[model samples]
Structures are given as C-alpha cells and as structure tokens.
Target: MFQLGKTIVSEDIIEKEFVCNLSACKGACCIEGDAGAPLEENEAKILDDIYSKVKPFLRPEGIKAIEQQGTWIKSDFGELETPLINDAECAYVIFDKKGTALCAIEEAYNKGIVDWKKPVSCHLYPVRVKDFSEFASVNYHKWEICDDACTLGKELQVPIYKFVKEALIRKFGQHWYAELEKVAEKNN
Candidate 1:
C-alpha cells in the first residue's frame, strides 16, 4: 500500500493482517524491545549519546519504564538487542490513568530540553537492516504486513522508512546512502 517512486509494497507481502486493535493489542511493536532488530554501531553510539544527555531530565516513571522493559545488551555479533518480548509492551511505554499509551522519549523531545528521538529499531517496524559485510546495502520490505484486519497494514509505513534512512545517512555519511540506493534498485 506504500508507494514512493518505484518503491511499491503490494498486499501480497503481508503474511498476516495485524489489526493493531491498540485498545487490546498493546502496540507491541512500539514497546517491545527485542523482537528481532539490532542497531548498527554508529546508530548505537548516537542513541547512547542522545539518551545519556537526556537521561537526567527523564521522569522517574520514565526510568522505571525503561528498567521494567529491560535494557539493551550487547550481542555476540556486537549488536545491541533488547530482550525479546512475546506479549508485554515496551518498558518505556506508560499508559495514562485514562489508559492511553505514552512514549517517554516523545515526552522528552516535546519538552524542548532534549532532542532524543526514537531509535532506528523503534522507528522501522517490519523493515530491518542487516549488514552484508561484503558491501553495505539497504533492504526495505513489509516483512510484518498482515491480512487479518490491521489498520496499519493499509496505512503508510514509509515515514518510518524515511526516518530510518535519514538517520543512517546522517550517521554514516553519503556513501551509505548511495549503497542504500543501489540495494533498493537491485531489489526492485
């Protein structure tokens, strides 16, 4: 359903239709840390620096949320992975007394005290990046697209894509972007 230039995501890509049904579903993708994604070295550093600078301002609830969800651990492959969650929401996510889910990082960013944004893993849901080792590449797809009744499957997933792409470009410079373009072209 998300089409930008030649980037076309057809419904066939969906393996299941996830209805989101946030009221009951708990928005696991947003909160759960270790589904399967891992951060690149550059990404990890940027995230660490930004959060480190903002940590002091984080509310006590924010600290509790992070601790409850579990922190990132270094993988054998050297990537940072949050503990995989099967059903629990992310630790940093808190529901208001009214039951609306809240993002702690979004709160910090909105306060104007810190610009700490969501990490790439959090931004890109179904799509994930894996190092080629031989050469860098950008792999984009709707891996988690579902067919059941998920509103998100019919909605746009590209903003997340753009955010992830932009962050990687900013972190690694232009060559990385060029490689991404190449990978995209080859895949399409």
Candidate 2:
C-alpha cells in the first residue's frame, strides 16, 4: 500500500482509499484552494454545454472564476486548466437560512433537472485527469494533509471512495472499470 497524505493506494491506485479529513480539519480543499484538470476537446464541449445551462444558478463571485480563467486553458503540466470557483468550492454552493453551505449541483440532481454527475474536478478531488494523463500530472491543493494539528490518525478512513469511484468511471469509462475492478479485488 502507498499512503499519500490521507489517501491510501493499495497495490493498485484505482482502489485507492480516500477518507474525508473534514471532521478532523476544516474542509481546506473546499475552503481555500485551487484545482485544475485537463479537458479533452470532447469533454470541453460537454462541460461548456452543461455549464452554460447551469450558469445562472452559480453566484456572481463564482462566475468570476470562469470569466477570469476561462473554462479551459493549457496548464503548466500539459493538462488543460479548468477554472474552479473560490477555493475550489463547487460553483453550486449556497448559504442556507441558518448560514450553512449547501451544494447547488447536488440540489439540482435531487430536483431531477440534473443527474448525480458533477464536474469531473469535483468528483475527483485530490486526483485529476493528470493522474491518468500521459502528458500531464495535476497537483491539487491539499491542506488537510499538511495541517499540523489534524485529528485523524495514520489509518483514518476518508469518505471519498464512492465519489472517486463514480468520478473515475465517469471520466475514464469502461476501459478503466476493469482495471479498477482488479485493484479493488486485489486490495479488498
């Protein structure tokens, strides 16, 4: 097994263990960070189409990220740089009456207008297309792993398996499914 921060990659990376460190530390990934991933031309087209439809639901501040960065660009690592909202929070986050943040995309999915699919970046936190990229390797922001006073121990579980699994499937499709299945089987 290979452990990188809170992520534990058993013999194969696809079966990597991801435990949410939010309970142990403030959600640094969502609170103060930046993340970028490459988009194949087709993926870019799909994102442009979907984001256009969901644009209105995003806060003006959130929209600024898209405006300033553009939806896609060439990244330093040869991957495409996809803009993310402030601190990488889902563009869909909104405050409740009690002032707690809520995910708008999740809400839309619940309302049936959109499906459970989120942008690839959100689905693959801490990991990105670059992880699979032949030409690039993304470096996602990770503060939880760096926090000195974090409560989670060496073996703590991160609540990201299902989310990551869905994202990997969504981004890589069937070919990777078999590869990941092998990883899961060998590790589990």
TM-score winner: 2
- Residue 153 lDDT in model 2? 23
Per-residue lDDT of model 1, residues 79-108, tens digit only: 675433343454345565666565555566
Task: Report the C-alpha displacement of residue 86, candidate 1, in angstroms.
Answer: 12
Best by lDDT: 2
Error of 2 at 117 (Å): 2.2
User: In model 2, what are the clashing residue pairs, if there are any?
Assistant: 18-158, 19-157, 19-158, 19-159, 20-158, 20-159, 38-80
The window of 10 residues in a row where model 2 has the poorest summed lDDT is 146-155
TM-score of every candidate: 0.51, 0.57
What lDDT tens digits, residue by residue, belong to model 2 across residues 12-85? Answer: 24333454554443444444445544356665665566666556666786577776766555556666545666
Q: Which runs in model 2 stand beyond 4 Å of their true positions?
A: 1-16, 21-27, 35-40, 67-69, 72-78, 84-106, 131-163
